[model samples]
Target chain A: MARKIDPDQREQHKAAIAEAVWRLVARSGLEAVSLREVAGEAGVSVGRVQHYFGTKDALLLYGLRLAQQRMEGRIRRRIAGLVAPGAEDVLRATLAELLGDDPDTRQAVRVWTAFLGRALDDRAIAEALFADDVELRAFTTEVVGSPLDAHGLWALANGLAAEVACGQTTAADARAVVDHHLDRLLGSPDR
Target chain B: MARKIDPDQREQHKAAIAEAVWRLVARSGLEAVSLREVAGEAGVSVGRVQHYFGTKDALLLYGLRLAQQRMEGRIRRRIAGLVAPGAEDVLRATLAELLGDDPDTRQAVRVWTAFLGRALDDRAIAEALFADDVELRAFTTEVVGSPLDAHGLWALANGLAAEVACGQTTAADARAVVDHHLDRLLGSPDR
Candidate 1:
């Protein structure tokens, strides 16, 4: 006889699985994740993992999307509260918060970094991230007033994230770079 | 009884193993590597992997160190021929070369991005990268001036790499960003 499962319970189970996947990735890197491993970590059967995610790649892809949306939501909320800062200042604040070492932000960083390598082969994720990157770089250029021909903002943003991920520099330092770039963009002493 | 192996032949085999390690990591990822798998890739026995690396972690750590050294050597070679370029110019050239999409450079980048996720959990690789990253950022700061702090430089480099890795931006765009950032560093007219 097939056992009826509760919808809410299933949703809760999926969330638990994602959380477990995140924890495992954080502790051991994304390569360390496996269906059996995730199922065991989440205290669920392998059948549950299959039912929820279909496959390991599906789980990973879903996890990646979850991470992206969560991050976008965080930034949107922070941007909502910026009140009256200049476009550059708002950008700096937004960037600082995104790269800062808060708990949730740190988890996102780990997940982002973990998936970055795999994105080289995952066309779907690569396409999405690439589009998002283009938009982000354009927004940065508009706010900072840097008349970069193309890929300028993206490079700057990339360099900053790599440094932060490597612990070679701090969030404050990243903000300072944004401010300096903004100053150049504004071409004014006040800036 | 174990067959008697020549020391020189043994050293050659170790080198071969390390080379294959990077290739596998670049083509797939660190997770795809295992002692037996690497041995097969290198046309050697599993016992040879154990003999050379002692353990999987040791092999990974060694491969990571070699990868960084390979990158540093490439960057140094690129910068060696450069002359009369100011700090910003130096940085632009250095960064452009580092992030270039040439086959060799791309291989290095692939190995780098893949290993970094593993490094997060492997203390040995983490410590080594941390040191290397500091030196790289410091050099970048020296070229970019005070306003473009190390962390900012780091993030910009990282973001650019990610952008390129995901094909959101072209190598030409990456060069453009480096050039613009250099111009800003040199206090040139904005845009």
Candidate 2:
């Protein structure tokens, strides 16, 4: 009898492949990623991994997209738990989530920085990355009431993420800086 | 007859090798940098390149230090050209030079980000890079009047540099954002 092909299992296998890619990227930089290596890391056949993602580029893109989705989902869930959350609260929560030094944020930063390097040479990735920036800026502008300050805030958050990821600044220090900046921008009452 | 090696010529050759490493990094990411590849790019013998820098780590450190010195020198020259330059002027010029979208800054960003990745796993490089940040924060504090705000400003500038290098924002736009933040922080008269 032919083996059954479960769609849910297929999705889980793809997720496993993406997680393996992230692990490889975090441990050895993006240059270490290869289909054969990923298969080895994922504990799957190369042909099975290939069945989901055709090329290394496709695999990378898929991983990046998956990471972003996971990040957004976490932010959404956090915000959803707030009672009548103000824009400032939402903004602070989102930026805090992005700049958090948790394992997820750490992995995302590694993958994101690796992608930033590749985006320099790939037009499609460049466009996708820039589009995300535009969306982020728009959301920030809604909270800050000034487009310029919103840009500054975005840059500041990203800078903090890099600093935190690199251990130049602790996560708590990063959180304090983000809160201070938010207070300055929003004039919110001191916590 | 022994071929004489002039000190100045030797310095020039080392500088050329560093430049080749930067070029390779900017073109193909940090993974592309190898002694043999650098020698090929610099049009020199591998032994000659290896003689100056004993390992890849040493070579990368040398390149980063050279780039930082060059950047500081450029900032000093720019600030010196200003008439009655205040701390704000000095700060602005230094940051403008750092965040400039010129080829030098572009290459520096590529090399810097590449080094950032390695610094995650290399303790010596992390220490070196963190030391640079601490020095920058002290200098910025002198200009910004607050150590915390100075750190924030430093993070903002670094983030803007990354964005500009990655094509998410234009150099001019980044300059404008920097100026606005400086004005907010320094209360400098509009230029």
Best by DockQ: 2
Instruction: Judge the docking of candidate 1 as incorrect, acceptable, medium or high.
Output: medium
At residue A130, give the lDDT of candidate 2.
57
List the DockQ of the predictions in order.
0.49, 0.51
- In order of the candidates, what TM-score does chain B achieve? 0.82, 0.90
Question: Per-prediction RMSD in angstroms?
Answer: 4.1, 2.8
Q: Candidate 1 has what TM-score?
A: 0.83
Highest lDDT among the candidates is held by which one?
Answer: 2
DockQ of 2: 0.51
List ranges where model 1 is wrong by over 4 Å. A1-12, A84-90, A128-131, A146-150, A165-168, A176-180, A183-191, B1-11, B83-92, B147-150, B187-191
